[model samples]
Structure formats: structure tokens, C-alpha cells
Target chain A: MTRPRVTFWRLFIVASLALGAYSIFVRFHEGIGGATNLSDGTPWGLWVGLDILTGVALAAGGFMITAVVYVFGLERYRPIVRPALLTAFLGYLFFVIGLLVELGRPWNIWHAIIYWNPNSALFEVAWCVMLYTIVLALEVSNLIFERFGWVRLSRVFHAVVLFLVIAGVMLSTLHQSSLGTLFVIAPGKMHALWYSPALPLIFYVSCMCAGLAMVMVEAFLSQRFLKHPVRVDLMARLARVLMIGLMLLTLLRFSDLWLRSALPLAFQPTEEALAFWVEVALFQVIPIVVLWPERRRASPRRLFVGAFSAVAGLVTHRMNVATTSFVSSSPTDYFPTWMEFSVSIALVVAGVVVFWGFAKWTPLFAEGEHPPHAAHRAEHVTRARPGPPTAISGCGRARRGARRLPAPRRWPGGRSTAPGTRC
Target chain B: MSKGMLIDITACTGCRACVNACRTKNRLDAPPGARLSETDFTVLEHRDRLAVRRMCYHCNDPACASACPVAAMVRTPEGPVAYDEHRCMGCRYCMVACPHGVPAFEWHSRMPRVRKCAFCPDHVAEGRPPPCATACPTEATLFGDRDALIKAATARIDARPERYYPGIWGRDVAGGTSVMFLSPVPFDRLGLRTDLGPDPLGHATGRILALVPGTAATVVTVLGGTYWLYRRRAAVAAEQALAAARDGADAAAREGREGGR
Candidate 1:
């Protein structure tokens, strides 16, 4: 049953990748005008709105999960941390590719490194994204080190894991808020309903909601495809956290509008007003309502619905901010071309394919306590008491089943010394 | 002394001499269309009886310069904002940040650069007025020191209250622009934005970015302190667990010896 589905996905990914490559070649050969719908009036289209902004915002899960486990010392949440990190790393890697396609002079992208513009909000965002991507790479490297049995190197990373987590959180906060700051300079061009003096604060709050909901979405997907177990208690707690974030975001949005006296704009019978209401409903109202009851929060299906809604809502909000709000001011109309949409969809597919490869090849969902170094064995041993059924327990069963089944011939080693055993 | 321009809309005729002069001076290939583009640095738009010439305001604190991530857009001390194409990465952020929406991009080029009014920096440096200002049939466009031009604009407004708008259009808008305008009617009716306010737009973004260092310091201290507290607590718990287990073993051994006796 699974074989046919797996082959279908593989074929789909390959076709998408080929189309993306052709579109990219056309972009470079014919220039941005021939390839994209973007014009001088609308210099940014789907590449900036969906691929860069939405993609980066969704990847906030990496910092959120790491802070929960490493900084807050919640050891029970350890099993999901590696998966979240892998997702984030792939998300950022694809963001760079999207940016390359969007940039008019792709080769000069490194000019931001040598040149300085401390006053520019974009300058801050560029620096932070570069730094944070590196930070995430280092954090995810522990899995690689363990898979190859580089115990000493992994120990070095383990020793300073706390510092790395703290830095990642700080970098994430800066860039995430600075994205909103980019639009703050153009109050006259942006619609009053979307424009506010507190935009940076609003962006930061909304990202927290998106980040938490994204983790839940990933958890549900992995459980279905990878045969990983879903921890009902842990997911319930995450749902509670997501509910609080959604509430905070709602409060921030309404209060900002109210304070600016732009609340009346939301009631107007206009396209902008409709978009705003839809965004609020998808991101704020629906998630909060679905996750309100304890029984619904515990049910995996309900939790997935709420998470998917929040993620969809985040995409809507970002698109509205990036494109729709400028409709009244822009001289020309912008709708992304088929080539643009293909490239964006292709980047997303590429991310999924890379994540799947990482999951299959590495010990991404290893069972038991996985301390990177033996130095941390004492801490793990002390906290080794059995708790609720988790992904860890599910992974142990999966490992045993894998031993009986035929292992893939492509692997360098046999089943006994596979990637998961060392870790 | 900063250079500036004062455009008196009341004096302009519907002739297009300035537009022709600007095109000729820049060596542009074709005649300008209805709007600004890479080929047209300035354009004259007809609004009822008045003819308004639109170009870069050359703001005192330009949002474009502040918005450029690589310092590609720069504000010259001579009062005009300049573009350094070699430094630009073509992010198009300046186009987004501009209040008047002046910057134009070359979408058809493989390596596009942002294009806008240069304010004739070369002409200004050589002590000659811009070609458009010199080519004006009437004294519609005047170029001189920014302060003298502001005084001239105020004098014109004060003398002809009935003929012109009540105030100088660019005197305080967006924290004061080097190029001021005298319009027969309200500026907004002429497609100029009046709601940009008196503060520089860059100040808003600057204020947010200024808080970064403090935010980073606070995060580090809090997270570091919390991790230390948790590790210490775990160590103490582990020591207690080990001591309790040892005690249980000693009791079992003693009870076994007593039973044997």
C-alpha cells in the first residue's frame, strides 16, 4: 500500500524539480521582465511574499522547540527537537534559493557583507538571517556527528548547547520583527488597516503562534508517514501554548487598530476589509475555537485541523501585508505568472524531499536518551524514569521491525551498526 | 551650501521644453511616456489649468538611502540623493520605501539598477544650474542655494496668497526636502502625498533597530541564568537519589545478618 504512494511522491517531486530548473534558466536567460509578472510598480511578487516571508516565518519552529527543551530544561520534549531543527535548516536553505531567483543581481548579494547600512531595517534582517542560518546549521550538526560516531566533536557542541539555543532565539527575534520594520517606512503607501506603529510587535507575536502551530503540523505528518508515535499529552500541552499565542496575537492586532483609530476601516465593505477579516478568522478565531476544549486538543485529528488553519492564516496575513495592502497605492496590478508559481511550488517540494532524505538516512527519530556525548550520561541516567508513551518508545519498535525487514542496499553499513544504533 | 530647486507651477506652460532638455542632457533614447521610468528622470503632468512637474524631492533625510541594505542610495552633502549602482544589489527596497514613489527599476536587464532623478550633481558641482532649470522658457524652475530658494518660495507665497497655495509643499514634508514646490491648488490633488508628516520616515525603522543590542543582551542573560539553575537542581536531585539507594542497600544487608544470627 505504501509502495505505490512513495513512488507517486518521488515522481511528483522529480517533475516539479525539472520545471523549477527550466523556469530558473528562463529567468536568467530572458531577464526578470520576461519571466515574472513583477514590474517597477510592483517590484516584489510571489518570491518575496510567499517564498521568502512565509517560508521564514514558518521555520520559527526550530528556535521554539530548542528553547523549550534546552533552555527551559524540558527533557521529555527531546525526541522532536532534531526533526524541528532539520525542518528549519531545510527551510532556510530553500529561502536562500528563492532569494537568488528574486534578486535582480544575484551575484552581488554578498555586497551586504562588505557594505554597511546600520540604519536600514533590511540591513539588520540580512545580517540576522545569515547569522541565524549558521547557528541553525551548527545546532543540526550534532545529529551528523553522532551518526558517524564522532563523539568528541559532538561533545564540544553539546557542552555549549545552551549558549547556541539562546543565541538562536535572540537572532530569530531580531530578524522576525525586522521583517515588519521593512514596511513601517511606507505608511502612506500601505492601507491604514494593515499599517500600524506597532507593526514590529505584532509581527513578533504572530510569529510565535505560527511557530508553535507549525511544530504540531510537522508532528502529525511524521506520525502518519514515518510511522512515528504521536504523544497525546505533549501535543495537548503544545495546543495549550498555541492557544495562548493566538490569543495574544488577536489582542495585539485589535488593540493596535483600536489605538490608531483605524478600527472603522475593518468594517468597510472593501476588498482590504474582507481580506483582514478572513485573516483574523483563519489565524485567530478558528484555531482558538478548535483548541478550546480539552478533549478536542487531545484528539490528533482536531489538533491537526487547528494547526493547519493557523499555518494557512499566517500565509494569508503575509500575502496581505506584502501585496494586497499596496493595491490602492501601486500604479499597476500584479498577479504572479505561471512561471513564478511553478518556481515557488517547486521550492516547497524541494524542501519536503530534502527533509524526507534526512529522516531516512540519519537518526532523526532515535529512541531512548540521546545525549551527544558520554559526559552528559549522568544527567540522562538520573532522568531515565519511564514516562508517557512518546516518539521514543515508538522508535524502538520501528527499529526492531527494521531489523527483520530487508535493509536497503545503499546504506554503507549493515543493520546492526546502522545510524540509529550509535546515537 | 546645499543646492535646491523651486518649481513654480503657476509659471509653467504646457510646452515640454524642460522634459526635452532633461532627456537630451541624460542622452535618453526615447521621449518620455506619461509616467517616470528608467529613461525619464522628470515628467510634466497636466492637472486642469496647472502643469505640475514631478521628480525626486531629494529629501533632507531620504527613506531610500536608509532603506538600501548596502548603502547604494546615498544622500550627498550637496543636497541631492545619489545612486551607486555598483554597490546596489537590486533589492528594490528603495522603491518600496520612497514616499513619492520616485525610484524606477530596469526589469528587462539581467543586471538592473534603480533609476531616478540625479538632481544634476555634475552641473551643481560645476556652479551651473541643471539643464532643465536653464532650459525653462519661463522662470518656472529655479536652482540655487537651498536656503535662498526657501526664502524665495516663501516670498512668492506671501506676495501672491490668492495665486498660490497657502504653504510650500516640500518645506516640512518628510522632514523637509531640498526641492520645494509652489502649487496653484492642494498638493494631494496634483498626485503628491501630503500625509507623509514632518518626521523622516527612516526614523521609524531606526527606532526599532536601536533596540536590538539590548534585546540580545537580555535574552542571553535570562537563558544562561535559567540553564544554570536547572542544571544545579538536576545535580542535587541525582546526588539525593544515589544516597537513598545506598541507604536501602545497607539496611537490607543489616537485616539479613540479624536474621542469620
Candidate 2:
């Protein structure tokens, strides 16, 4: 009954939480002025730039995965549905937490529900995000019910799961585009390199890429750390979708620039221009290069790198849109204080911890009847851990050599039954 | 009728009386910078020899009102974009959406609210001129009917064509703001944004948002139909397989019975 030994990741998370707690104290005690470097000209800073915007974009995977599995009937992806939902739910929960820290009057946030401004795009986004969080909670409750052996509750959830999923998809679509719509009023404030009338379309398309890439990254991480059996074919299929999304996003973005006669701005020796190009390289060029190879594309590590690159690119893009785009118009130079950065980093660590905890406690990767590794699935352990592991020993075992545990029945590179096909 | 202000930069001395009057009238702190803040609603700035007073334009179709998620900032019929601190959620979208960068935040305070000029609606309600306007010695900041102000602004530019800039700022920019400016130099040179077109800033975003309902309905129908079709086909396949298995079992039993007979 001894707790697992603490690893570097666990130690890092703990340290971050402690440091961030102090900053949170300062923020509440002394107000935003003491904790952040934000001014009247630069009111939205790291919290809006990284924590809320990028966080929400990354969470897009939940709706996409649910749509693929439930609406399209892609049963192959059923294994990853719960994990995707968990990641999204945690992402959004932390997003709201970050917003609370950022908002001057967080207590009045519920006012958005009571007062409706039909003309305001932020109003739409606020409403959709609020509603979607509820929808996601309901969608994700099935796993919790099953884990607790609430058979009747689980049955009720199943009956309404499809309705919840449909509502989620609709809500996500509204807010995902609405985030971009928030910037439309700032045509003069935002640099020409990032501003366009087609911003909503660009945002929607890029969200698809972010969502697909995040799903791939999640699938790879669970396979790596949780020691879930590898499903290379599934990852490969998702990669293809990610690649297609990246291409469409690139095409749309470049076409927008070209049509607006803003293409010249991209070549300028300015910070905004350089950032734009970096976004293109990370989100568009690198992922395309990595996923182009049939063999390498199927490799779990390679796919993961590509997916991570795409996610990173999208994060940068969102940050650019939210904060960097306004730099030219800002009265003073803005850089986030250490306290702000720590708070953001802490939120991420908190999210990761919650995701890892949920994966361990619930049947996130309990592969179903048609699992590739049916033997392994048959031996699946539903035994609840006495308490949470202080750290993952799986990482250590992975480093020492994977010889400690039984090898997966099949590797992604080959069919296990065919000797010659094994890589 | 809606009111307005016409500020003639050429007539004003850099005495800053209007700035002081604004602070005293609004009960705000004496701020150091020429920019608007929670404590500073209006600031008197100098461009070479010309003295200019800066504050909210109070647009006919206010972008801040449009961008406010909770309608905390509302444009009144009397030509003021008023803010209700009690209704504010502190989202700061209004600050970002304002074309003139007029809205300021109470960043230093724990319970902050958006701070901006409301065109001195209290005085206008009493059928009196705004404090800034009344305090101006040269009538540099004129307050009256929006139409009369525009006509006067145009006449000044036309009568002394060599002394004034041709365009009357806020006459059409951002859908004709209630506060207009007449300057000797170009409006941009005087720190006013001339880039905003006549149409309201919210119009573009509004058009895009209008598509949401139709798009959502379409998606729901299409996706729902797809799910229904897929489920029905799966159910049909299952039923056929069950029937086939039963028929094979019945035939095998009959054959065994016939052989025994």
C-alpha cells in the first residue's frame, strides 16, 4: 500500500503549484497591478493570450472526437473518446480558472447569462462557452458513473449522450469562430499581417488542425506513459486528417493574405512578420514534412512530434492574435511579469495532473470488444488504486528498458502474425 | 434631440482649463499623462502650437456599446455612451473595440470598472452645456445640437479655407460620432484616428455573427440525419444476421429429424 515514488514530473508540478499559489495570493491581496504588468492599453495579457485562447483552441479535440465517434460512427476511435473528453474538460475548467484570475470582477461573470447583447460577439462566445462546459460535463459523466457502478444513472446518461454531443458540437462551432470574431473590431489595432475579414474562417479551420493534432498527441502520450497498447493505424488515420486540416488552413491563410494584398507584410523584417512565418513553419511546413512519409508517418514517435509541432504552432497563432497583434497600437511595451507567467504555467500543470489522475482512476483506455489487443483487454484491471500515485513509475521503467513488462501483442510497424512484417 | 461637441483646436490656448474642469466635474484624480485613465476622463494635449482636448467621441452607433457582452455600456438618445459599473462584468472587450482607444480601465483597483467620457449627460439633461465646453474661454469646445455643430464645423472650414483642414472629423467617421473636431492640421497629425471609415466597426462582425443560427441548424440536421441513417443500417444488418442464424438452426434440426424417421 506504499505510494509510488515521486518522479521529476510530479516534483515539478508540486513546485509549480506552490510557487503559483504565492502569486495568486499577491494578485488577490494587492490586485492585478501587483501581479501583472497589464495596463489600460494592454489589459489582456498572458492569461488571455496563452491560458484562455490557446487553452480553448487546444481543447477543440473533445468535440471533434465525439463528432467522429458518435455522429460519423467511426467505431475505431471509440477507444480514445473518453480520454479526449477528459482532456477538453480539464482544459476548459482551467481556462475558466485563469479567466477568474484575470477578470477584475470575477464575481459578476454570471451577468453574461442574464444580460444578452445580441450585437456583441463576445456575448455569443461567453454564452456558448458557458453552455458547452455544462454539455461537456454531462458527456464525460458516463465514465464516472460506470466507474462508481451507478448502473441506472449510466443508462440514463447513455440515453441522452447523443443529444449532449450534438449540442456540444453546435456550441463549439459558435465559440470557436467567435473567438476570432472578437478581433474583427480591431482592424486598425491588429497588424495587417494577422488581420483579415476571413478571420473567423481561418480560426475555424485552424481549430480543426489543433483539435486533430491534440488528439494524436493525447493518443501517443497515453500509449507511451499509461502503457496502453499502441494503435498505430488509428494514429496514422488521425494524422492523415491532421495533415489535411493543416493544408487547408495554410491554403486559406495564404490565400487571404494574397487576396488582401497583405502578402508583402509577411516578408517584412518586423517581429510580427517573423512570428507569422514561424507560425507557418511550425504549424504548416514541419507537420507536412513529418507526415508526408508513409513509413515515418506511421511511427508513433514521428507522428507525435508532428502533432506536437502543430499544437505549438496553433498556440503561437492564437497568442499572436490575442496580444501580439495589438503591440503596434499599445501605448506602452508589455511583457508579462514573473507572477503572470507562473500562474499560467501552474494552470497547465494542474490540467496535466487532472488528466493523468482521471486516466488512472477511470476506464479512459479500457479498450472495447473489438480492441486490437483483445487478450490485453480481457486482462484489463478495474481495481481502483488505494490512492493516487505520487509519480509515474512507468516513465522510469521506459527509460531502463521496456523489458520489465510483457511486449504489446502488435507493434505499429507490422502485423504481429506476420514474421517478415515485424519492424 | 441628440447633442454634440465641436472642438476647434486653432482657437484653444494650452491653458488646460477644460481638463481641470472635467476632473473637477467628474470628481477624478489629477492624472499626470495626457492619456485617458480611470481617474482622467479628458486630457489637453499639444501638437506644436495647436491645443487639443481628447476624450470619447460618443459615436451615433457606439462600438463600445455593441462590444459590451452585458450591455453595460449603452448609447443614450441624448448622444452619450454611458457606462453602468454595476452591470459591468469587466471583460474589457469595450476597451479593445473602441476605435479611438478612448475607454480606459481602473487597473489599479481591486474592483475595477471601465472608465470613459459620457459627453457630460448630467449637464445636457439639465439643458446646460458640458463643463469642458462652458469652461473653454474661446468657445473652442462647443456643445450643442449634433446637426448645428456639423454645420458650424463645415462653415469654419469653408469660410477660411486657408486656415482650417477641409474635413470635419467625427462628421462621418465611425458612423458620425457626436463629438467632432476642426483643426488647422490634418486630423491624424493632431492625434485623432482618420482611418476609421464612415460605417460602424461592429457591422462586419455583426454580419458574420448573423450566420450562426442558420449554420447551427444546418449542422444539427445534417449530423442528426447521418447518425440516424447509420444506426438504422446497423440495426437492419443485425436483424438479418439473427434471422439467418435461426433459419439455419431450424433446417439442421429438421434434417436430423427426417434422417431418424
Candidate 3:
């Protein structure tokens, strides 16, 4: 039987790209006023808040993977690093493009470099994002260089990989937390429900949870989509990271709620209050319940759902803080236009397509941690022709039972009797 | 002399004319108050009954500048928050990290960026004033040296303690505000969150951060260099191991072929 082929994502991307391009041209001619719904009352709407700030945090899965692999020497995560980096790279790339279009004087966007502006938080965010993107690009480029047989270039990049990795890690850390700092200034405007001194720190830590959740979801989907079996060891490790981040996130929230005298407000039973309770319930409480256990984390289905819930919770929390919970008596109420949603869709779909194409074409999957199921995952059709197998059976799929390095070949040291293979 | 802009929200009428003037003077899109883009610097926001003219105050020690791993948001000596989108990675962390909720992120479309008010330093440097200050119909906002703004803010507070209520903002809030404010109503009533203390928001975490560029540069260089060396060693070992494995595989394949022959 032929495997199910999906064209929806690619087709959707083409449509959105067309719209985005058209809208961009329209911006040039008529200007952004005609294109966006931003107003003096509601200065930033969906594009500025949702697609960029929130999106960047979601894409943070890349650096966390790298840190695990290179910094902590978690050899098991090495395989997932390339894919995670690719996702991070594309997420930032889309963000970069989206930001460029938003620039009023696109040409003068470089003035921040020639003339320093140490007085602005935006300035730091800009520089960090720029430098970090270059770092991520270099990290991803190493994979390409190795794949193309450019041994020397690959060596140079590999030598510098640690630098790029560390840089990426540091950059992600600063900006991730800084996102909360943006809203900290508006204590009056933000609902007492969400505002706190530790907001920036909380936002940063929350990203850790969101990113790990996305990684879990990505792992499951990739396993199914790419026809690779999930590696148990890597999944277990990833689950542990998610568990730790969530635990910390929970502690931070509780401590902050206590310090601010805001704990009682959560009990008022208002809509915002209820939403808060529900969000925490999903993002922190429920996930903790399912994830605190090692056995549950090891299960693929449980891990996926738990991670999805955590990511959803974080995303909602961001939206709440940025817009929903904070009812700045400000005259603006922002809603992303269909065009905005289209653009967001385009970025996500593009990242997916890129990941799939790059994986098929390049050696991106040669990561340090090929999941515990490396043998099973790697036991796909030959690279030349990726097709369904002749007979789908337990033996065919389970042929990779002893894929570990220490494990002897399946069926013991049984060398092929017919082929004069060295025993 | 560290100079800063003084913003008196009581004088603002929500006209957004200052936004228009800033855009035209800044060579921006001149979009109406509704169509805010990254170019629409000095946008206006109506919080409750308040008309907050949003712009980047040329802070004395800005979190944005210090957080910058690269020198993108450099505060001019005179005190203007200038930006370079090209140098910016569009991370939008500044939007997230800013204490005043001033910086805006560009989150839509194919290409996005940040949009914030850079004080009209070009005109100010030429001995004029910021466009927002000049364009205000009610003179709710003023452009002057930091000292004068502080003095004026203090006098207003001293003269009418009951009228001003609480205290003058930026006088001691979050280190200090480059743009000072004098409100007729309570600041909280005006939808401005004035609860932040004078402590540097960055330092509020109770951790002292090295914010200078030279220090950050050194840290980046040292960290990067250290990681590079470690990775080089690891890559070398991994390569040697891979080479050995490949050689063994090739020899085994050759033996198998010869045996078949």
C-alpha cells in the first residue's frame, strides 16, 4: 500500500507567501497604514506581539538541544540538534523578514549600528537577535558542509561550533527573559493577575517549558512523518528536561503570586481569574501530574499530549500578558487580520517544508542522539528511493532490536553463512 | 549634562499630531494614528482617559543598550534612543524587556522589526527640540535638559502635593525617566503603572549584571573561544573514531567480496 502523502502544508505556504508578497508590495506603494490595523491607540497588534515575540520563544527548542549536546556532553541529544537548530534558524529567519517589512524606513534600518543607542531595550534585543541568527546559521551550515563533502570547511565550522553554540545559548537566555521585561513597565496597564517584578524572568523560564514541549511534539510527529521509530533513551531524556523546566516554572509562579499579594486575586472567580486558573491547570498542574512520573514520560502518547498542553498553556499565557489579561484602558483592542494569520501560517509551514526537504537531501539526521531507536529509525528505505516496504511485519520493523553499539548484531554473532563475512 | 525629554501627559489631547510630526521629521510613513508600522515612531495610546504619547526616552542607562550583545541601541551622549534594524535580529526582546512598555515589536507579514520613538536627536543636537515637544498643541510634553525637567517636576510636586498626588514620575522611578511627567489626576488613575521603584529593573532580579559593551564583548569572546576549543577536540576524536570504523568496514567488505570471488 502507498503511504499517505500530505500536500496541504506546501500548498498553504504557497498561498500565504503570495498574500504576504502582495501585501508587502502594497505596503511599499500605499504604505503600512493601508496594510495593518495598528492605530495610535493600539500601537502594536498581532504582528508585533504574537508572530515575533511569542514566536521566537516557541522556536527556542534549538539552543536547548545544543546546550544538552555540547555543553553537558549529552551524547544522546546529538541527533536531534540539527533538526532543532534548523527549526530555530527558520523561525528567526521568518521573524527577521517580518520585522524588515515593518520597518518604516527600511533603508535606514542600519542606523542603529553606526549610531549607538544604549538607552533603548530594543537596541539590545536587535543586536542580540542579529548576532544570534548568524550564530545559528553557522551551526546549521556545518551540517550542510559535512553533507557536501567539504571536509576542510566542515572542520573549520566544527571547530567553531562550540563558540556558535555558546553564543546561541547566551543570546537565547537574554532575549527569552527580556520579553517579560517589556511588559513589566506597565504594571498599571497589565492586569494585577499577570504583572510582577519577576515577569521577565518568568517569561524566560516559561519559554524553556514551551520550547521543550515543542520538542516533544516535534519528536512524535517526526517519528511518524519520517517513518523513523522513536528513540526511547532520547525521549526519556527530553522528558526529563521538560519536567525540570515545568517544575521551576511552577515554583516561580507560586513565589511571585505570594510576594505580590496577588494570590487571592486568582481566587476571585472572575473570567480572567478563571482563565488564569485554567491556563495554569493545563500548562503547569496537569503536565506536572503526568510528567512527574518516569513511566508516563516514557510513553510516547502521554509525552506528546503533555508537551502539547504545556506549549498551549505557555502560548496562552503570553497572549494573556501581552493583550488579553492586560486591559490597558488604552483605546486599542487588537485582533490579527486574516493576512496576519496567513503570514504566521506561512512561517510555520515553511519551516516544516524546509526541515523535511533538508532532512531528505542532507545528513542533518546524523545527530549525536539518534533517539534510542536509532536502528529502528534508521531502518527506513534506501536514501535513493523512499517507499513503503514490501511486507509490514513485526520482524521487519523489529529487525533493529539490537541497534546499540554495545549490542551484538541481532541473532547473536551469527555472521552470514553464505557470504564469507568475518565472524 | 545628561539631558532628557519631559513628557507631561496632562497636556496631551490624544491628537497624535506629535506622531505625525515625528514621522514626517523622522522621514517615516506619515501613516495616520491608526496605521502604526515600525516607522510610526512616537505612536499615541489612549489608556482610559489618558493620551500616552509613546516614544523611547533617551534613558541614562538603558536596559536595551546594556542588554545588547551588539551595539545596536546605543544611547547618544546627548540622550536619544536610536535603532538600527539591520543590526537588529528582530528578536523583540527589547519589546519584552523594556520597563516602560515603550518598545514595539514587528510581528506580522513576511518581514518584521521593532518600532520605537527615537528622540528627535538630529534636531535636538542642532539646538532645537524634539518634534513631539514642538508638535504638541497643549505642550503636555516638553524637550529640555534632564536637570531642568527634574527641577520643574519637583517644583510642581512641592507646590501642589494634593493636586499631583503620590509624586512626580521618573523623578525616582526605575532609576529615572528621561521624559518626566506631571499629571492632574492620580498616575494610576491615568492608566499609567507607576508602581515600579527607582531601582534599575534589570537589577531588580537582585543580580548584578555586567552591562557594558566591552565587558559583554569580552565575555562573548572568551566563552566562544572556550567552546570552540572543546568542540575542536571532540570533533577530532569523533572523526578519528569514525575513520577507524570506516576502515574496518571497508576491509570487511573487501574480504567478503574476495571470498565470494
Better of 2 and 3 by DockQ: 2
Candidate 2 residue-wise lDDT at A57: 87
Write one digit per residue (lDDT tens) for candidate 2, span B33-149: 777887888888777667778899899998889999999999999998899998898888898898888898877678888888878888987668999899999989999999998
* TM per candidate: 0.91, 0.90, 0.66
Best by DockQ: 1
Whole-model lDDT for model 3 versus the true structure?
A: 0.66
> Each candidate's DockQ score against the native complex?
0.58, 0.44, 0.13
**In terms of TM-score, which candidate is strongest?**
1
As for candidate 2, its clashing pairs are none
lDDT of 2 at A374: 52
Q: Candidate 1 — what's its lDDT?
A: 0.84
- Residues A1-423 of candidate 3 have per-residue lDDT tens digits of 133335664566688778777766766666555676654334445666566776788789998888766665555666677778887888788887777765554565565566564444455566678788888888888767656656446545655666677778878877776566555544455677798868777887988888878877777778887765666667777778888989998999988898888889888867668779878988998788877878776688778888888978886787677665544434566566666566666666667777788878876665543343443334321211332231233343222321222221111111111011111
lDDT per residue, candidate 1, A129-181, as tens digits? 99999999998887787677774466567656777889899999999989999
Instruction: Return the TM-scores of chain A for each candidate in numbered order.
Output: 0.87, 0.86, 0.80
lDDT of 2 by residue, A303-372 (tens): 9999999999998898788777788888876888999999999999898888888888876666342654
TM-score of only chain B in every candidate structure: 0.96, 0.93, 0.69
